[model samples]
Target: MAPSSDAAADGEPSGDVMTYHLKAEHELRIEVDFDRQVTVKLLSGDAEIFGCELPKGGAKTLSGVKCAIFTWHAAQIQIVGKPDACYEAEASAAMRSYLNLHTALEERRKAAVTTTSPTTKGPRVLVVGNTDAGKSTVCKILCSYACRADAMHGGVAAAAGHDHWVPVFVDLDVGQNSVTPPGTICAVPVDAPVDPVDGWPGEAPLVYYFGHASPGENAAHYKALVESMARVLAQRETDDVLARAAGLVVNTMGWTDGLGYDLLLHAISALSIDIVAVIDHDKLTAQLKAHVGSQGGDVQVVKLPKSGGVVTRDTNFRKRARDRMIRSYFYGSRSELNPCASAIDASSFKVFRVGGGARAPNTALPLGATSRMDPLRVAPLPMTRDLERCVLGVLHGDNAALGDADVLSKPCAGIVCVTEVDASRGKVHILQPSPGSLPSKLLLSGTMRWND
Candidate 1:
């Protein structure tokens, strides 16, 4: 049966509390209003947002999330709070194409096993599109399908004693990373379906901090991180048979013009990508085909239609998303993690900024010198009020002997958000993931700051 809605008559506006009864294989698409919050709960049956399953009888609040709640079987759900639009839609044709691609990859994986190939190369998919083009969604679906295939084929357990067949998910979009905190590039191993609402659970992702929200802001640093991630993925593929057969699903940022285009090309070469799926843009597809063809690389450029469910997000919405990601890092998606918030003497820790606080304009720089600053240059920052509310990356290296460049190049152990800066008492209160003294006194500061 199709969903039947019932609104309350208690003087509140309609849709303030609405019930939906979704038939099997139906989805409830919610396009949330700008700057509005929506709360949804599974009243009966089973439904999921993204990869995360909804609680059996509990509610999940989404602020600035435009998503589809889908179920393979019949389910009913109740939604409170306001939404700009709400409707039901069957799975699109693009989803079918994605599944077909997965089927082909599965065949290749099986063939490799049968032939006993030394170097098994499965599908290395790279997803690229403009902002809000649903690149991440495509990647998520592909990863989920791969996980499901593993489970069905008895890939869950290995003859050599392993837990599951883990596929590598390389998140190159540092600003909106699915596997780790914002401002960091991560390569996560996904063995199961991701949480539909909560995203990739706080797994142990290999992260490389880029120290900025946008790749354009720190192009050199971003490129370096991408290279690092690609190397990591390459090494993992060589070492693990399941990982090599499962291959990689790389998610890129939505900067498809000029330098962004160049960065995409760089990633293609660096990752040795075999398939490039260009979403919803004919021009981008043409450009990628031409570029890849000219280079004589064995890359298949495929154009994918954008989903009707994809909601275009504006600047404010993007900012809110970033903030939410940062908050989710420390507090978790369900606010279940108890992050430590304590005041420490400012003199106890040394804070440093990377890339000399952004590059100076060519006109402002000395004659004959390039405008771009050294990406690995780190400068010590004096404790001040400006440092308050800034996110600081706790470095893994020792503070004493490391040079400026070494400091910027090192990966961070964790991060802390400055809550208060007490100059009078020389103390700074910070919110961190755990209690007690920090692992390292050397902290790396960046342009990325989270108000929450």
Candidate 2:
């Protein structure tokens, strides 16, 4: 496709549209800028964005995203607007590798379905990689493939005596979470392919607030959330045979050194991971293999090459993405959401922060004493100006009976943002998803804040 030389005063697309014919096993990689929008439509043949099949003749608008339109067979696509970067590649080893891994996992799923024993459950895969190594993409592709009945049954109809797989997608990346807002980890069952425009389904995600983007801020708190999530998923799989056979696809944050690496290992054990997919990192791969050997587990550590089209996002870009996630929660992605803002007395709900207290230096302590603060302690947050623009996690439990330990493990119902705090009237204004009172009065605070 050649660049158009059309005249448009506002820099929008005029009449010149471009079309590209992708060969078999090829992909069209595109990167759109944050400020601009691009429209893409499939003209002919089968093509998919991420793993969701593109609807023929329907124009899908994309902005501030870097994605690929892949086709197992040949495909023809049309573009109406210019992207920051666009190109078609004839070969993509990363996509091939992802498909192969999906195939092996499918075999495990089939075997799990044949047995009622929990020991023969399907593969629980944990994907670990550096930032921008396409870990999220890998997870999405795997989950999408798992939900594709045609792919599983070799082009046969799913109604032909076969049930669809509902594999669980666990997102541990707090900084840029695809399942839920930032500063939290969540899991959702994927019964269908994820939308290319809208990432994951939002029906009933199990979310835990970590209060900060990076796990390094409170590594203990993060690990506790992981353990809680694993426990809940284990119970869920135990009760549901299909979900157990479908298993899980876990995505981890891109901090793979020292404490970060230790957290990864802890997650593997906590989640009962069967396959550890290391994306484009040899040292991490080897280290994981060695650790698995020492632990005497059946964890298969496979190293996969990172896609060349994976874009490296800077700090500012990541911050903007996080803000978008927050904004999207209250105000939908296309401004389709109308959140209700209400003013309630400050005393109506209790806001608590997890982990942060005065800590004396270890050097200043007695010979055998440790001055470390309890990182899991939950303390009440004072209502003040600091609460302004802060995002609060609405916990799911009895407000009066919730203990500190419950705060650490309880799944959040939803999130609310503090719009205004009136100390004079002892009132606080908050914006929530629906037009009703909060599900619970126990709110959890973290470092996440939204301007709007």
Candidate 3:
């Protein structure tokens, strides 16, 4: 839903919304003109018809109809010849640029209130996401004078040092809107809490929404939540009373093959410019190889980490990341079943099973995919593949949260999910795609207890 009840459609020229990464794919063009008709000439075995031609005081659209002016909308751009071509291309490209710019602007505007103030030479990091993706741990470990996050969750949210601020939340699951308070985890110091008194938010980091919900879940509600949060954080960056931090460290919600790859991509695009992915060595190397840029024949790709810190009023980044950690620990996963230990990061991307008789890797199959895994079950998708497409609804049922997420491995447009389960212990850990051959079907039943 729109951030405001009064807000109209998302800022884009509406008719059909086609989400494609033009930057990574193709350049669009268009043309228009005021001229007369010459004749209809079909060339190349009548394969390519240049134009139908128009009358002197008339115009022609990209579709080849003659008129003073005409508007054509299609993924394949219209190329008119000569003067008209220049004008059409200019107008079409200009319009699309404005359209995308407007969409980005409007999205930010709706969520502007939630952005936190900035820090010094880096972004005001706001830690968000589901449990165990290292949201709080990362914030606690973040050095640099300007780096801070309000990561503590739960009651009496008081961190000891510069990173003592707490995370805030809005009820976005349907009608829930009450502010989330700190919980048990925030009170217990898994490690020494960052002392907030040591460093005050010199300038608060701007606030931004961080979430772990898969796409098509409650993500859209973030627009409204962000707006609300921005209002409180946009204040002076240094004000310390529950102030927000500058950077947002979004810990993903992954447990036993959840946090689908598509979800990760969406999060990277939405929350972080730099995706510090902790995939296994092979996958990372493959991505590095796939860096198809013209800069000296690829591999110069950079996610572009923010050079300088941000400035905003949200100063309690550490505490917030901590709080989110607590919430996610308690509410997001099958804590009873798996009993998560600690979060993982680049350092611990691989999980080792101590004593189950190990089976060898499955190299007999190929790690290929398709856009649709099972067309019969999947919703009718448009011809194009849009990663942003998601399954809607809270993943609250007794069934596995990953039922839909498994679609990632489909060839044409799939997520690339990697499930890790300790069948011996009836435990599971959904992970990002690790390097290897074809996947071994994680037998959740027959080997694992179906119900808790």
Candidate 4:
């Protein structure tokens, strides 16, 4: 309510720091506002003060003024006047608080819709290849480029040519993770990638392991791998890591058979992802197409460089064919959805995170809220010439075998696949399209095998 006499008592308080810098042709105007008489003073790296004071009012700052405040601190702006002479003290504090709050709110708003500025560093690119395909050589080239570019430009271009840049390097390749092998770049595993710059360890990405599964040897380990992969991907997706991935490189083991194909399909299905790019393996590409066709998805094929596909194998010339396949995996249109703008140089085995793998309600089971093991049973279609084709396929496919399955209404096209509980009891299941509602013309029935 009342003014503080102490604050106004001094024209310039002791122990307060201030500084002033003067450039050529600049005027430093310091206004001395006081209810009482006071003197003006400017102290710092040599600054001249010119101004006059009309005695009745106070000393007015004069001409030939040289005042420029660039970036100098510890200087002084002092006022000598009677106690309680400057303007109300409370008003100044209120202005300071308002400005601070306004600035903070503005910053928060900017964060919502900001794109990466190019002045920031670019992401670190790590390239890895299978042993024979010159994995080390690729690393060498990357390092050569990264080091030279960083040296010349001061650092990896932090300028977010797009989004962000992390200045970190880590390695975790089971047993082969080493960038210091002298010729090729070493692999880094999640357990021990590069150390964190500020306060965290390197983050591990899911290895998109694109190789063919080992055959005839579906040992316990294979199952374990599947479970482990599922669990890992689940954790990452839940934690939002999958959402942040830029691009993934999938390295397949040099084989393309049922095991590899199945494993690859299961993995993709598990992630429910549309592949972005293809590596230079023709065998893998064909398998990929088969799976995509089944799922009604589209993908671009990128073949590897033909010139680089030369490698020594079975016969000198035949090995050439193998080399071409390897290069082809690297060929394809850009993965339309690489979270990162750049293609990840690592194999795909590491990037695919487990996504929502929940299966839809079984269409053949007449979905219910309770038990899910029952089969959807509908009566055999009444002999109608138009429905003969549909009836034939179902009968062969075990649609007519069910005593309880009564044809409910208009005969549908074809039953897709079926599941069985007991193999010895001759139990079969028939799958149907996920129709929205039961067709009025057919009486849909469901059957469950009660082996007990």
* Alpha-carbon TM-score of each model against the true structure: 0.85, 0.94, 0.23, 0.27
lDDT, candidates in the order shown: 0.77, 0.87, 0.25, 0.27
Better model by lDDT: candidate 1 vs candidate 4: 1
Q: Pick the candidate with the highest lDDT.
A: 2
Give each prediction's root-mean-square deviation over alpha carbons. 4.0, 3.1, 26.4, 29.7
Per-residue lDDT over 1-452 for candidate 2, one digit per residue giving the tens place of the 0 to 100 score? 33333343344355446788888888889998778788888889999987888989787889889999999998888877778888988656878999999999989988787675777788899999999999999998898888885324332224333457888999999999998999999999897899988889999999998878888888888999999999999999877667788889999999999989999999999999999999999999999999999989799999998987788999999999999889889899888989999997898889999888445678899999996688888989989989999999999986587788999999999999999999999999999989988888989998888898
Residue 215 alpha-carbon offset, candidate 2, angstroms: 0.9
- For model 4, residues 1-452, the per-residue Cα lDDT tens digits are 12212232344433322222333323333322122233434433322221111122222232211111111122233333322222211122322332232233233223322324422112222222222443322222222222222121222223323222122222222122222110011112221112111111212332212111132132122223334444544453344321112212222233335554554455454433333223335655565666677767643332322113213233432333222222221221121221111111111101111111223455645546443332222223222222211111111112323332222112222222222222243233322234332122222111111110
Put the candidates in TM-score order, highest first: 2, 1, 4, 3
lDDT of 1 by residue, 368-432 (tens): 98875676566789889898888888877775888865664566688899988989999898999
TM-score of model 3 relative to the true fold?
A: 0.23
Residue 287, candidate 4: alpha-carbon lDDT: 57
Regions more than 4 Å wrong, model 2: 1-16, 150-162, 357-364
Residues forming the 10-long window of minimal summed lDDT in candidate 3? 443-452
Q: Write the per-residue lDDT of candidate 3 for residues 278-393, one digit (tens) a residue.
A: 31224432443363232233112222111011112122433343333333323432223222222122122221111122222345335653233221132222211121211111
Pick by TM-score: 1 or 2, better one: 2
Weakest 10 consecutive residues, lDDT, candidate 4?
344-353
